[model samples]
Target: MAAQLREILLRTRRHLLLARPGEQPSRLAGEGLDFRELREYTLDDDIRHLNWKSMARIRKPLVNRYNESRQISVGLVYLNSGSLAIGAPVSKKDLAVELLTALSYAAARSGERVSTWFLGADECAYYPPGRRQGDLAERNHALATALEAKGEPADSEQLLRELGPRLRRRSVLFLLGDFMKPLDLSALASRHEIHALILRDRLDEELPGGSFLLEDTGSLRRKEAVIDPAAREHYRRLVREQDAALFEHFRRHGIGWEKFGTSQEPIARLAQYLRRP
Candidate 1:
């Protein structure tokens, strides 16, 4: 496990190194006191920084840019639900950990403070923001250990209640999960910049056509089910509806999201998402 994590970190570092200048994965712009330049307003720009006077003069929506700060805070939340343990060849939990490690390493390498929270149904393990080398190493180890352990069902309410109050600063938050549950993140989105990395498996969307026994990973309960053509179609439709609703909610709340299959490499995909202006 240790060697595997080391390899992932090594690959992540190499990937970051290969990225061209100005395309680094860090997207958290600083809000410093020093004024920078004025640029056209983007959807991602904070409305508080909108230059009303400049907009009235130029007749174009513009926002004030501030000099980037030396350091910024990054919060990573891992939704450790049992369903993440389901995947062929490799589990979603493993993929999530890989992505989490990459993001944490990148942030720490850029001299930004990183905080991590592994939240489950009954437990929550939080590591406060730290920029030191030792702190990053410790966080990676803990993240690996948590992913290997059995996960409980996800409790969205508990997650919001616990994580919301602790994040006093307006930071960049990355939410790693399958997100199969109904979620309302308006409060968090309003306070911070949120990016969601949705991890999923092919099997989640399409089930094989046959009769088989199914088990709920969260409850460890078994049931017999027949997956005929009709059943498969129904399941597919439900999944589509669920995803549509999820994406719509994200759009309405101004949350940036990207979906990654468990079979694919997340480092490159994550970098691409972060490169968005």
Candidate 2:
């Protein structure tokens, strides 16, 4: 079933790729296959792409057929915090993986390289950019495997410290996390175009009525509680406060923010978000 969903996700929403401007010709963008005819050199053309042989033969400065040169790097960073395992219709972790797959595939289809970072409690796992056409599936597979190995709350501060220096300046970064832990994104915000995807569960925010014992997925600790009106209201207020703070931080840093619910269709929501001006 999971494999089927994966294949369907890969095939669906291909139209979004067409909307992407990555295919546009740019003298700074990297060269792609299927060379076009060479033309007279222009001031805007990069000298590195110049065809020295053609210039010598024609006695005129000419550039090669490879005109496109800008290689936009698209990166997805996932927070492997234990809170993400909570699920109502879908697990936050599962939805995150799906969203990453969709984003990576869309970027790859648009001729951009896709990279992923899975930040866990004990350690962080990095997947290098898969620029080649066939590597997308492998990258997604690796991401799926990493998502399955979730643990305690990830060390967001430490992970960011390690990751910031490695990323290319102005690269597009998509951050997926439950946002239970406060993150210091100052360095990342200054260097990268950040898209923050906050994963949440409806069950977590709105407590259901009745007395039940709930166990923490990661710690294996149990707590019995009654979900009275006051308790429910308190939970709602706390959630709102957290969200407000998170949104404020993102706004201050000029990062794009979107909330993904476990009940929502990950790809559709992301596609809609991308379509927004």
Candidate 3:
């Protein structure tokens, strides 16, 4: 079931990427180089890219409006610590990849340069951002291969901490993970705009009363523990609380952000975000 969700995320993001109208600006700035359309000459025009030949043809002046070329630097970074193996509809780890894929496709669709980085248990991989569709495909393949080749979870917090200091540019940075491990967002917030994707598996969603055996993904560790409804309820409450607090912090700092679950239709959310006024 979780596997199917992963496939859906991949397909939906790709579709959105390909279907974007070439005339739309990547964001509110509208300073991109994409050619949008033409309009009658106005006093406040750039006065360049002006069709002088068209003026002779129409015997009138018209202004050429251009949609911004996708120039925003959007980076997708996913954390692959062992703790993400905890969900059902989508394991936290797979969902991380899916989120990265969705965001990458969306950025590319907007002509925003899309780069990707995968910090797995033992390795770190980087894929350069590019405007062509092929770049995303290559990045997706790399993400899949990295997810499959595993050893043990790496220090996710450490990864974020390191990223924070080096990135002083205004790029969109997404950090996908389950906060089962702690992170220093305050440090990251200083350098990059960080949006956190918090993932929770369906199994982690509900807890049945009584003792039950549970299995871990990579480790396959077994545990026979009593299901205290209160404990599960507490877990759910804490997750909600933390999610709100995390976004709140980003908001307070004037950092751009959005959060979604593994079950949500990521395309709609992304389209709405990218197509904002």
Computed on alpha carbons, the lDDT of every model, listed in order, comes to: 0.79, 0.71, 0.60
Candidate 2 global lDDT: 0.71
Which stretches in model 1 have alpha-carbon errors above 4 Å?
A: 17-21, 26-70, 148-153
lDDT of 1 by residue, 142-229 (tens): 6655665355645657867878888888888999888877778887898888998898999999989988999887777899988899
Sliding window of 10 residues with minimal summed lDDT for model 1: 17-26
Model 3, clash count?
Answer: 9
Best by lDDT: 1
| TM-score (C-alpha, index-matched) for candidate 1 | 0.83
RMSD of each: 4.9, 7.9, 7.2
Give me the overall lDDT of model 3.
0.60
Best candidate (score: TM-score):
1
Instruction: Give the per-residue lDDT digits (tens) of candidate 2, residues 90-184.
Output: 78877777776667666775677788787777767788877664467446655565556356766657767657767855688888888776776
Model 3, stretches more than 4 Å misplaced?
A: 1-30, 33-70, 120-122, 145-157, 160-168, 215-221
Q: Which tens-of-lDDT digit does each residue in 98-216 have in candidate 3?
A: 55666665566556676777776567777765767545845674555457523355463767644544455667777666654445567556755566665655554456677878766
All candidates: TM-score: 0.83, 0.76, 0.66
Query: Where does candidate 3 have its weakest 10-residue lDDT segment?
Result: 23-32
Clashing residue pairs for model 2: 28-69, 28-70, 29-68, 29-69, 29-70, 30-69, 30-70
